[model samples]
Target chain A: MDKTQNNKAWFLVLPVLVIVAFSAVIPLMTVVNYSVNDTFGENEFFWNGLGWFEDMIASDRMHSALGRQVLFSAIILAIEVPLGIFIALHMPKKGFWASFCLVLMALPLLIPFNVVGTIWQIFGRVDIGLLGHGLASIGVDYNYTNDALDAWITIIVMDVWHWTSLVALLCYAGLQSIPQAYYQAARIDQASRWSVFRFIELPKMSGVLLIAVLLRFMDSFMIYTEPFVVTGGGPGNSTTFLSIDLVKMAVGQFDLGPAAAFSIMYFLVILLVSWVFYTVMTTLDNAETK
Target chain B: MMRARSSAIVMTVYLLFLLIPIYWLINMSLKTNTEITSTFTLIPATLTFANYVTILTDPSWYMGYVNSLIYVVLNTLISITVALPAAYAFSRYSFMGDKHLFFWLLTNRMSPPAVFALPFFQLYSSVGLFDTHIAVALAHCLFNVPLAVWILEGFMRGVPKEIDETAYIDGYGFGRFFVRIFMPLIASGIGVAAFFCFMFSWVELLLSRTLTSVYAKSIASTMTRTVSASGMDWGVLAAAGVLTIIPGALVIYFVRNYIAKGFALGRV
Candidate 1:
């Protein structure tokens, strides 16, 4: 649809602009202000120039947190995308069971982040928790609180349990949109199940798959509350990701200049990914409209 | 028939994996702390509603839910009310910097709540809105409004421009036409946007926790108090966690009918 030129249309947009500016722009500017300046108690300040950014860039702690964050995100994508696709393929196509599956699967997603953390924290406890107690009983040594590998695994599994449904749900919707005619054509050809999934479903799901990947990646990158509640960044900072580290610096230690500098860099990374997401989504929207 | 059976088996195993942890949570919520620590039972040996009783009877505990609901509802209302017009503008009209505006709006959605937490504390504090329900509601608008706009725009774009032209030729003014005609057409879109808004606001802990303290402390914050009081109060903690899941569960249940449809058309 061709849109008319309308300068007056800004009126419709102005409310969003004002609300976002107050909430987004102003706080963002504050972060910038802190990133470039030094401050002491009673709001004393001095010019810091690029010093904080320079420090954060060279900081090994920052590098390690970023490394862990990237690896976590990679692992999440690796597990969730395939698992979600598999689950979607096996899901009941239509009927009471489909509705039942959808409702049950969506339950974890709606729960608050901290509650999710709490659930896992209790569920993974060595003394009382089912997973930990069961593992112990089986002679499999595991303690999420003390072991770094266990902590990592626990967080990863917790994330998978919390979020895989989102991926499956998106792909299910994509699958639903495929006409029965396509399946009938495949049947006439006697296409093997693998071939049907590969040729028909895979290509069809590409659009929503990208959407699933982007959402999962962006969200997994920003994970904080769940991990925080579970491990409190762990036995020895073993589970501390970027957000956890930033919160420790900014709020826990009150290192405003460095934390703010770290935030800018952190945001820049998400912004870059989100820009790609925006471009792809806009292109998809345009294709549909045309 | 064999293939369908295998698929059913696969989904059954997967669903079991999902439900066990939740079941474990419910099981813990129903057991006493002594039972939780002393024994590992698949089912609670002695079912008790003591934890639920403790939370429901405690003002501090139950008010956390109330505070969360108030702000979530407020934020959703504000986000949708503002986003509706903005979405209409972006979906239907070509204007100066509209593309730039849209992209900028999305950046906020992607912005980490951790990044905004400190500055929002300062901003809200300076305005003297600190620790108030309204502050959390306004602070949450940072992400929710942008998301609402994006979702609403997607739904609005599907509405043909012919509807507008027909309404205009019928001598309906823009306001009446928009309110009476355009809105009804995109009502599902509005519902979808509102649902997304509510979900994000409800799940978010960082911003809401930061923007409010006592008098308006959210359930998530209130839950944290259990961690600090002497030893862990496992039963009440589990109960609070279970209660927190209730509202979200109820919300999802109500929207269960439209959830798939909502997601198919909604943006992240």
Candidate 2:
């Protein structure tokens, strides 16, 4: 199917670039501009020359938020990836039941982040919320507002409930795409179920799982809405991820110069890590295809 | 056989863990504030629809739903319209600076929404678009359009080149073929993309909250003011949260199959 004529499909792409540039690129440039300069309001601006960047990098507030962000992303990947794989493994391969399970697994994901936070906040209430009240009745002193450990548990549990389904769904797709002949061959070799999964399924799931991990990492690193709603970055900033802190700087304090610099640094961290994930995953994809 | 039984147990436990919070939310919505605050009940001691009734009868609360719905729909429409052409271009053509452009679009998706909350408020207020649904809708498009383009482009590539050739040989122009044949075949993918655009825009709080103090406030934004003279209205908050789940739940239930595939498309 050699093409002798140019279709001039460039027409299709121009609208996208234009819209995205207006919506994204312009705002980003504004943020970049703010990061290096000081403004006193009413369109007055002065060059500050990396002063905000230096302040942002050295600030303990920034350091703590970065630490929390990294830890949270690591925890999310650790829990969701394996748990999703386990659930995917157990899911009925083909039947009415399989479809039913798939739909059931997907329900949590459909709920919005803020709503998820609200639900947990209510559900974890000691007086009215079920989990908190139940825990108290059962002799567990669980108060998310007062206890740092409880706060961590609540957010971590909330995230796992919301996102593990995504990983499961992705891995399920990878599993579904596997040819049945491989299973039959494994059976012929008398491979154990554990061996079959370890040797065959794991490798087959690498591509989609890479995607799952990357998406989860990126999202977890930038988590704001749910945790913000749940704790309001409370219990002494223990649960304040990088995003929430950035919001506090930009919106709460109206420190545009510092916040903008923080945001750029934040964006760069996500970009750098995502780029690494993409490179490693694509290389593996290439090797697998070859 | 033993392994199968254990796996079933594990899956059941996992499902229960995932659902219990949502269940509690629904249960609390059915209870009165008195019952909610005074005692811990596994099931509501007495069920009431007062919370739902409050949200519905009150024009202000229900207005949040209307506002969120309008902007989300608008955002979805605008994103899909822009992304369809863009995604097709990326998928079909090796244009100048395609890789760089694609990455640039992705950077939009990756940037934190919180970072833009203040600027968006200032920018929109200066332009007199503040407190309008259009403002929130347009702000959402910043990220939503990039996401829609990436996902749609992935699904579009899976469509065979043979279809394009057939349309071309039949003397069907690119526009006609795209509308008549290509769109229908990728209906599921488009549905998936539209659903995502709707979901993101629907749940988004920061910009929606900052940009609209009154008119375009989303239900998520409304949840912020759930505290009243009577203290935080757990019953009302729970009720609002449950209501917020309905739109996305209904949409996902209908497109359950596509949701899985669409996620794979977006991420990859």
- Taken over the whole model, the C-alpha lDDT of each candidate is 0.90, 0.84
Q: Could you say which candidate leads in lDDT?
A: 1
Give the per-residue lDDT of model 1 (tens digit) for A1-290: 79999989999999999999999999999999999999887899899999999999999999999999999999999999999999999999988999899989998999899989989988899898899888999999999999999999999999999999999998998888899999999999999989999999987887788878988998999999999999999979898999999999999999999999999999999999999987987798677657
Clashing pairs in 1: none
Q: Against the true two-chain complex, what DockQ does each candidate achieve?
A: 0.74, 0.59
Off-target runs (Cα >4 Å) in candidate 1 are: B265-268
Error of 1 at A77 (Å): 0.6
The C-alpha TM-scores of every prediction are 0.98, 0.95
Cα lDDT tens digits, model 2, B1-268, are 9977887898889888888888899998999988877777778889899999999999778999999999999999999999998887877776667767777787788778877777777777888999999999999988899899988987887787789889999999988999999999889889999988988887777788888888777877788866534568877888888888888778877887777778787433
**Which candidate has the highest DockQ of all?**
1
**How many pairs of residues collide in model 1?**
0
Model 2 per-residue lDDT at A86: 89
